[model samples]
Target chain A: MLSLLRPGSNPRRELEAAAIALLLSIAIGSLLMLAAGVSPGRVWFAMIERTAGDPYLLGQVLYKATGLALCGLAVALALDAGLFNIGVEGQLSAGVLACAVTGASLPESTPGILAIPLCLAAAAAAGAVVGASIGALRAMRGAHEVITSIMLNAIVAGVSLWIGNEVLFQGGTTRGNTIVEGAQLPLLPMSGSSVNAALVLALVVVAIVWFLRVRTTWGRTWIAVGQEPAAARAVGISVARVQTLVMAGSGALAGLAAANFVMGHKHAFEEGLGRGTGFLGISVALLGRSHPVGVLLAAVLLGLLSSGGLAVGDLVPKELMEMLQGVVVLSVAAAGPWVARRSVTVVPEVAA
Target chain B: MTTARLMRVASLALAACVLLCAGALFYGGSAYALERWITGGVALAVVGVACVVAGAFGSTAMRIAAVIVAAAAIAGAVLETATHSELFVAVASTAFGAQALKIAIPYALAAMGGAVTERAGVIDLALEAKLLFGAFTAAAVGYASGNVYVGVAGGVLAGMAVAALQLGLALRLTADQVIVGVALNLLALGGTRFLLQLIFHEGANSPPSPAFENTVLSNPIFWLAVAAAVLVPLAMLHTRWGLRLRAAGDRPEALVAVGASPSRARFAAGLVGGALAGAGGAQLSLSVGGFSADMSSGRGYIALAMVILSGWRPAWAAIACLGVGGAEALEIQLQVTGSGVPRELAPLLPYVLTLIVIIIAGGKGSAAPRSLGRVS
Candidate 1:
């Protein structure tokens, strides 16, 4: 089970395959750009120059990466337990709502230190509740997590809309009131950038997750249950309990992503906060091969593409970037089994 | 505990919950509530209890009887909640029925597509993508050429294209079906949105295209969908081809012993299913007279759910689709009638109902295809 949890191939080989996939996706994207009557080279050059050369643009990448990394880690955690957490979108929505509500309710004079942690904790708990419900449904009702999670997404959308209209909406406005100043994370001392403390916090999360997964018995047991439930059961592990626990942990991680938008940037919840970021996390997990370190790198790469896509919207439509991301994920999925087969044949005699 | 006993207990619990909730609604001190509606709720609860008793103590016939009574009870509840006029109830139900038929056309077609493909063992999670691509191409072609037939053909071909991608990835290369399906969905969304923007210069909707606006009885696609639904089951039960398809999914080695390739059989099934789903999509866009990115919404997923809820059978799948459509139509009617249910929560009824039905059906006991998600 442990062996199955870890990839058999060397890290170098996996890295090489990832790089190739990225380049191929870019190539396909360029062809589409050409067909659309745009010059890919000019667009690529502009995107790179804007994102890498300018500090403000770089800050934007970091800001986006903070959210993506947390969500990516959330997905990786679920994947470690052999579960697909498609409800991350719904979970994140609930989390941001909880964070905003709690932040807004706090006294104005509350210390930033206490207020920030309280808001984050509230978001995590809210997300965990949502996640645990789906887990319970899967365990007790014989429901597929995929279908239930998707259903929860629709339910969350309706609930969020209702809450926004009835409870959160300020008088004559469409959005909730802003959080108190004490609850907001302090921004980095940089000119022309809104990058806040979330980036540092995201990195800390990544380190902690990595340690838990590699250096703890609990993580091993979770992975064991995921890889082979029947064997785990035979060995006296309660598969249901592990699944529920991992799912809650996964939800909490995804909920923490709300901090990037609610506390670090917008300081209030509204419709479309970090829209599509949840789905993007799935792709990042796949690209990173569901490893903590790999998820971080993939999130950063996607952050660059997204921020650059926005910067170069004039030269080529930003929709192209979206298409490219989809193309990359598809190409990787299509190639994964074949690559795994080849690597297995090459390695020869690895114990099953 | 044995699964059957577990299911029986769950069904009993559901019945008890229904009765308890109904009793609370009827007897609770609401000053302005109607007596007739409360009586109707109690009647529904009685039928639910009868079903639970049959499930616990009766034979298969009794269990089926219980299911029928439960279904009727649901219909009664909907009628009571959505309409108040006893004199006009008949008239209102006719209108609601027509709306349900209209809403159900796409679902029936899509669910049929799902049922057939899943029976052959290649998971069709890309149904959503196929629907989106089909809708877009159908609208675009119809608008450009001024012929509905061309549009329909475009839709069919577009669906086949998406199926071909699934076939290559899932069958040929043996990629994870779920992952490939998700990727295809994302691709379809992005690709369609990009093209819609590029050609229409609009972010949301396309120009109005020609459409079939005939009454339900006169609509050709509606009949086509119904015929497909009826014939698929007959074909599955009586035909040699049907046997081979089932064999391919349930016991591919037996199929291999007979000198037939399971992969080829699955490929053919996927193609036919894709075409049907595409027709559903084409009909959707035509009904609305234009294409919108969010038009299909989650109908494809709902169709997938219907297949499971129906226990992998075609006729029952059709029934499930009608139920979902009715639920949706009732939601709309409730808003029109000022039934006082929170409007924001009304749209979620169909999805929540699907989840409940699946849970009651007891998960893996739904008689799924044996090798459904396995790679050959």
Candidate 2:
């Protein structure tokens, strides 16, 4: 027991231990499945086969990955700035509502070219307003962003429910008003899936964010604030301004994600459209270690799990997929400290 | 502080309250309007007063204020019911009485668990997972054994298992405790959901058990919970173990110097927290007679908030829980009455009030224990 208290474990050893832990978790999950009278091997096989079994299934996975990628980027940006914006769900919902409302309200005779930008702008604007409120509260009153963001999430949920149920709700139906054909996102031919041009838009935004973070003076200041707030303030950085901008940018990205889902696929705002994607973005960001390219990979991995889970519902229960996803997140998170500890030796002089 | 500044702040807060109330009233109309108004306003007032009392007279005063507010809210509800005034009755009964208790009890129990763990210097943000574990375990055991007692025991054991896992990571490996806690929660949630689907061929919700009974005035569980509320504080203040736990939290280095293992204290506290949270889950599943995926909802998070609002005192946390719980119950009641109040606003009343309270309290000098989220 006392041996367990010692620190300074080697990096190689930690990695091996993490690998062992992952294997052990899978073993335990298998045992659980066996106890419940299911074949663990069959479930695993089903999960793999369903994801890569067909081109159509593969397209769905990619489509889902696109949204996760954007949301993950949003989360990564905000988290790197030392902000925990739990209100991403709210921001995304509001964005969806805004895009749907704008799209639906557009005249059928309106030029399709103008309507597309208008819908995206409306979505971004909605998300920005919500995100800015959270930033302002943190910057001005010093409210804990976590708490405020959570509260804002609830508020946004209520507002979204109201909009879907009362205001923008399609009369005599449970769904929202459908967008005009002119406002509908153009889909790629022969894809069969509603995969649209927004995928390219999301990629463009990702590149822009990467460039801004790596190349701009503003990005450096933002990182400075995140790494050492007092030091940044002493150096004449406007912490509040940086925070506000980070939040707005995060919100706008989240909104764009929602727009991609609504205008591009569903063609209307729907209750529970955001589902838990907002919170899922956090997991993606963590798994990716806040790297843009890493986020893309993480998002794809998650998308595979989700789409595969749905596809194999006849063979393995969806709950099993959820369990695997949860295990993946847990293992990754648990490994973080061990990983950090190993890297600590390389930068012994700098305190993390 | 300048009078002008104080006045400005007060007016702004009041304006916020008025706007929220008006929003609810307008959206809901006269149907449950009174309930909406009281639910939103009274809950906010309770949080505001608790903050002020905590600031002025110390944490002990805050405890007293929380308890008094809870009791008063309940009494006000009963009185409203007695008077036959529609407005008062609607507000009091629906906003402050039975409904509020439901919301508060789960939160209070979770908060108490958090308080003990934090007071012992272990970070615990996995309360939600603990709750799910308890709920799932209790439901499963109850179904298998056909005994509520067995279910409760199973739930507590599940919580203990989570605590043990957390301890292994936090103490043995010296992992980032918060992240570990989060991982544990996710694991528990997913694990429970999977097991439930596999075993019961259903989602997380469980069927009602015959052995379980609602904890009304005549029920033993009601009294047991009350006993727990009273005993936790007394034990914390008077017991040798409690002092050691506090010492471990406030200054683990000092404790270590004196030959005490901070890790041991933390482990013990974590176990106790698990037990409390487990009991809360049992109460929810067994007392309610059935389970749903959304049953726990965000109660665990609310409990964490209550721990902050109550300054880490068990008794105070209980009272605050009751207040919030009462507000929730009242919201449901108001909604049932079909008063003009919008159903959405009624459900949202407690959260909005909590937000307002946090805003009014401002960010300076929170009553949270200094040792919270800090591990040696």
Candidate 3:
């Protein structure tokens, strides 16, 4: 135990320990569930079957995945830029509100083509403003983006609540205004779930972001800034400018996610619509290692956990899935440094 | 040198008078606002004087003055704000005081726990998890045993278990502490909810605990808390363990050179922190007689803010917690009187005020601990 606590322990051993720890956490959770009279095997089977076996349920998972993917991509971008953009929750809320309000105000006779684009634009603009506020605060006043973003999220929640209650409340109800039909995103062909064109849009955005980050000069600048802001500055890069641009882009993606959720699925902004997605996005980014491909994979896994857990509620408590997800995130984070250290050791051994 | 000290004191005095006068003028523009304006002005004046005195003399005397001034200001402000001719006072007195106390005490305790842990060189961001675990275990065992004390003990034990688990990974496995902390919070939330649903056939909200009938407040516990608030700082500064802890935080290598184990110090600190936070959670359910899904209600986060505002000093944290608690109490009071302020704004007041405090403190660069957030 003392040796385990020492600083100079081998990285390979640490990774193995982390894997064991994760397995132990799962086993303990399962035992607790069993003690509560739940059949752990049945629960596990139900969760998997609900996610992959049924078409309708699978569609729900996909619908959730699309939103998570967009938000995950946003987080990935921000992480790559070394910005912890926790304000995605607020940005998403604002986007949903903007989409709903804009759609409600538009003429019923308006074409779906025009209305959809207009709503998307509105969401993007709102998100951009929020994202830029964080960037500007960081650049000009040295306020930490994490703190400002969190404060902004609270402010947004308050403002959204006020709007839902006071202004855009449909027919004097506390709920949000009903979105216009013309503004709703059209569903994909024969999908039982409300999977819409937004998935395609999200995919396009992901590709664009990936291309920019890996292929463009600006992307290289962002990577440079992320790695070492001081060194980037020494190399004549404008760190502040890059940070602002990356953050704005990140907010835009989150806003788009909100727009997709409201226009394609809910057709109305609900209180708590963000549903802890902002924080979950942090987990997704970390789990994905800030890579686009990794983000997509992580987002899908998270989506499966959420939708599958809900679908299998009769067999397993949904909270079990949440616990598992949290454990996975923790294990991954714990494993990161050890993995880095192990690679170092392996390279030296191979050279020898 | 004494002249220089006196000059510094006089300048600080002048600054305080100026700020108070300015605050009075700013808020006293309307006759209806005069009382609140004056109260706020005086409080600011007291704080300003305390700051200057601390700068001129030493932290020890400054801390004593802070406690006295804090108490006096709270009592005076509560009295004036509660009974002033303004209609807001009556509502504020009745409604805001109880509710805010209900919320603030738990947070203050959690923050004090954090203060202890951070001061001892361990990074503890799992306060929310600890709180949730305490609440969950207390509710479950309390319902089972039909004894609130047993529930409280169970909660503390649960918290210690979590601390031990986190320490195992953080200290032994060299896992990232923050990540583990966040995971622990999530696990507590999800695990508790799962158990609640499975066993009680209810959602996350458990049945109320067998409440302590308000006798605990009358018992020695309340006084003990107060005394602990006062003495912990002195103990921390003067005791050998305290010295080791501070050394570990400031310079872990130095502590190691002096034959102390940093990991051991951190483990002890983490356990103590967990226990304190657990007690705070126990106070919530066992004292209040009920449990809800979000019983902790972001107090864990508020405790984090308090740790920052208090600058890692336990006594200062207590003072900051009191101020926050007072503000919360005032907000509740205003709400009850049906003051002109919107109901939404009432709940938002503390958060907004804290944000402002953060901004101002951030401007001065004196709010947070210098060594905070670093691995070493």
Please give, for residues B1-376, the per-residue lDDT of candidate 3 as tens digits.
6633543454345345534543443344566576676676676666556545544553443544553454455345435544644544553454445444455566767787788777765667678778888877887788889987788888777777777787777767566665666677666767677777777878757776687665434522244346667776776788876776676666767777777887787777778778778877777777776566767655665676667556677766666776677766666665666544445545654555444344323311343333444442
Q: Least accurate stretch of 10 residues (summed lDDT) in model 1 chain A?
A: A1-10
- Give per-residue CA lDDT, model 3, range A15-46, as digits (tens): 46445444654576577668767887787677
- In candidate 2, what are the lDDT values of residues B48-89, reduced to their tens digit? 564455344534455446445533543343334335545455
Per-residue CA lDDT of model 1 for B1-376, tens digit only, reads 8644665566556555644444443334554456645665576565657545654653433433454466556556555544554422642667778888888988888888888888988777788888888899999998998888788888888888898888888888787787777788888888888888788876779898888775677666788888998898888778876887788788888888888888888888788788888888888887777899867777887888778767778777777788778778877766676554567877887766665555554345537888887753
Question: 1 or 3, which is superior by DockQ?
Answer: 1
Per-residue lDDT, model 1, residue A262, is 92
- The clash tally of candidate 3 reads 7
- Chain A in model 3: its TM-score? 0.86
**TM-score of decoy 2:** 0.85
Using Cα atoms, each model's DockQ against the true complex is: 0.45, 0.36, 0.22
Expressed as tens digits, the lDDT of each residue in A313-345 for candidate 2 is 776677776666566656655565655555666
**Rank order by DockQ, top first?**
1, 2, 3
C-alpha lDDT values of all predictions: 0.77, 0.68, 0.67
DockQ of 1: 0.45
Order candidates by lDDT, high to low.
1, 2, 3
Where does candidate 3 stray beyond 4 Å? A1-35, A128-152, A172-174, A233-245, A346-352, B1-87, B91-102, B219-221, B363-371
Which candidate leads the pack in TM-score?
1
DockQ of 3: 0.22
